[model samples]
Target: MSVKEVPEEYLSGYAEILAEVGRTGRRLTRDEVEGRRALGEQAAESGHGLRALVIRHLAATRVAWPRTTSPESVLAAVEQAIDAFAGGYERAQRLAVRKEEAARREFIDDLLYGRSDPGRLAQRAERFGLRLAHAHAVAVAAGPEPYDDTHPVTRSVEAALLSRFGDRRILLTTKDGRLICVVPADQEEVVRYFAKQAHAATDGGRAAIGRPHPGAGGVVRSYEEALNALDLADRIGLDDPVLHAADLLVFPVLARDREAMADLVDSALGPLQQARGGAQPLLDTLHAYFDAGCVAAQAARTLRLSVRALTYRLERIHRLTGSDPTDPQHRYMLQTAAIGARLLDWPAKEL
Candidate 1:
């Protein structure tokens, strides 16, 4: 059949599909691809060979300036155009996917960092398939080394969280070397389970979970709380794979008033500075003693010291600091000071 014999409607539909692919750089959906295939079949059944019709249509839609007239040459030119279109389609699909992922990451960053207003954040969340109107908690996971979105552990945790939370209600992303997730409040256990799985996957990494809070603003609060909980876990030498903010609430509260904590540490434990060795040994002894419930024998065993040596150390502590660990009131003050010291990292820096 001559090039002019091809139907205008079929040519126009194909042109439109090509135009869309060019304009938006999106891959054709399955339904659209199938529709075009069906059209090819229809053309074949109507006594026009599909390949011939395609070549003729391509020639018809070519740039206005003519270059060739032979049938074989036209066919070759059409084939080359088809190859170029396929290559462009593949590139466009990859670019589209990258753009989409970039957009999602930005939205997650903004939501967690409180960069957008609550109402707008909620709207954007909904647009991104997140339900922010309900109760939620923030969970953060850290590996031994730093990670970003491209890290294997981050991608694995994101996939695991989506499997549990079904994508719509959970927002998962990586920022500042940590994998952060916002999940439903009631799914704390599930979140913890995923965190443990991620930790194991990353070979002894850890995760921290915040207490559940309500609404969009609550997400930001939960994120902050989760970060504080992570810091406290490291400071206090916690061994659990998943640490909860509620469990470490006291540390954050104590850390809030830095000046008061400093004063308490100085007034309660300042005299220990005059010990023969640095204060760390005495501080370690006191910590072990308190951890052993003020039992000298248990503390001595833990410290690998003889009972007499432990007693001498305690006596020296009392002599220097005037706070007898055996006395309940003095022990309370001393314990508080020890806690404050650890919290503030006192004598090391102001913190």
Candidate 2:
């Protein structure tokens, strides 16, 4: 409906032609309008307006065309007018599609970034008849997938999929025009539904399959996990039918214990305060370092300390924890614990 209406000139011209042909108390001769009528018919069919001519002239008397009008002139006018109308329809369709695409992208970003409220998300879930499980596996499906960043099929397929299951839970986000659907752990049926929809929608693209997503919360990493799933699937051929983030939590030691991690960081550094004593401040310093990606220079600047002073502090942490601060593994353990400790507001554990 966003399309512009037909031009005034087109409407006026159509009426003018009818008047001219009907003048002198006689219709335009068959010879005068036959060629032009054919042209109008051709225009209608080519523009997906097969029934346009009938609709446009429904009220006019059908005695005969060209009885008074010139066939060549009438055909040219009909052709031009119909073409303009078709253009309006196409433009309207395109605008409506753009609006839907934008909404889809917003939904996807919110799930990935944890930026949206529960109400809006719930609205999407309800509209799609999505049944979100307590434990969900969220992932971004792409590559040979159903769409480019600017596609309409993705929307269509999504609408179809949502409508396909009325009692199930389904939540979706579309980034780069690819769908990120979150389904329940027990909902094998729903995941398959998504896969089918994706394949069907991705028509003419690479074989469509998606990647694993992150767990709830820490949406940034969850999003990364989803992207990695797609990459790994394309590169290593690991996932069947679809990929998921659970594949990446391969290390036992890295599995989280929220409360224990909080306790560990608290005890280890609580009494060792030169900057803030033992655990908490030292943990903050280490986290900043890792988050800045282990760049001591950037870490020092953020900590507002001279490079040499920050280096001395890092050495002290190594001595107290009996772990090398420079090691990637050590940084990971320290940063992870630091986050838990900071979030939990508990002291570090003694190592």
Candidate 3:
């Protein structure tokens, strides 16, 4: 068979193989196989449909089957060429996927960190299904262990989000070992669903949702609020699996003035250090008392103590701090001091 006998458009150098095999009954050389692979890669890189390329090759093979070569030899050569071609095509496709993932990762970093110009960032965001013109809310989930995009919990959360929302202007990604979900502020249900799914999936995990804000900088602010909520939850030993930044706003306000907060801690809790077991026992008592709404029996149950024993501890706290636990005015002072101590991690580390 001559080169002209094969389909011209798709054959490329395939007809050369046929002519050589027809004349010599030889299999494809390594160089010829490599050349075919390179052609496949070029076809892939050029955006030619794989199916179309394969069909073209198959048609050329039929038209240019070498008459002199045994049918078995010709078929074997065709198989080797097709395998190499497919290999190259697959390799190219994988490379394209890796490049795309890298670009997406970079874009996410810039968007979340506010590292790019607002105009440019908003433009880039459109490619990823985000519209920064409207208000957006951020929710973050932190588990017992760090998570990545491929983690089972992360995959489950993504699957859930996609199923419920159908890829609506929602952006979900993992950053700094936590799962972050950003959605339009109006879609409160989406964030709520995410929190539910994330909490359910992470077992010993918790999720925090931040208040909505508008614009590119809003995303950063919401993300930081979610993160801060998580940090506050940990420090304060909050047990709620789903936390809202809005609900926890007071903690941040109370912590704003470091010196004042430190003074409150010293004035209200410092005296507890004089007790037999020191401040921790008294601090635990105060934490439980306030958490139980000053109901002596309930707080006793929480601390696994008799009400009498619990009241004695409260009495000791009152004496040491000069603030009565049952009195409304003194209770405020003690509760605020307790919150400050937790935020400052005082007693464990000097404030």
List TM-scores for all candidates, in order: 0.72, 0.42, 0.92
lDDT of 3 at 165: 88
lDDT of 1: 0.74
lDDT of 3 by residue, 1-351 (tens): 333332344457787787677777688999988888887787778777777677778878888877773777777778888888888888899999999889889998998899999999999999999999999999999988899988998999999999988978999999989999999999999999999999898986899999999999999999999999999999988999999999999899999999999999998899999999889998999999999999999999999999999999999998998999999988898999999999999799897
Ranking by lDDT: 3, 1, 2
Candidate 2 lDDT (Cα, whole model)? Answer: 0.54
Residue-by-residue lDDT tens digits, candidate 2, 1-351: 111221222233455555564444334444434433444434433443434433544323233244544555545544544454455455555665787677776666665676767556656544544432245555566646445543676666567766887546666556665666666656657766676666556653222323322244433454566666565445432435555456544322333565465465555544445454445567667766775688889998988988888788788888877666798767666666555454454443323
User: Which scores higher on lDDT, 1 or 2?
Assistant: 1
Instruction: Compute the lDDT of residue 298 as modeled in candidate 3.
Output: 98
Ranking by TM-score: 3, 1, 2
Give the better candidate number (1 or 3) by lDDT.
Answer: 3
lDDT scores for all predictions? 0.74, 0.54, 0.89
The candidate maximizing lDDT is 3
Our tally of clashes for model 2 stands at 47
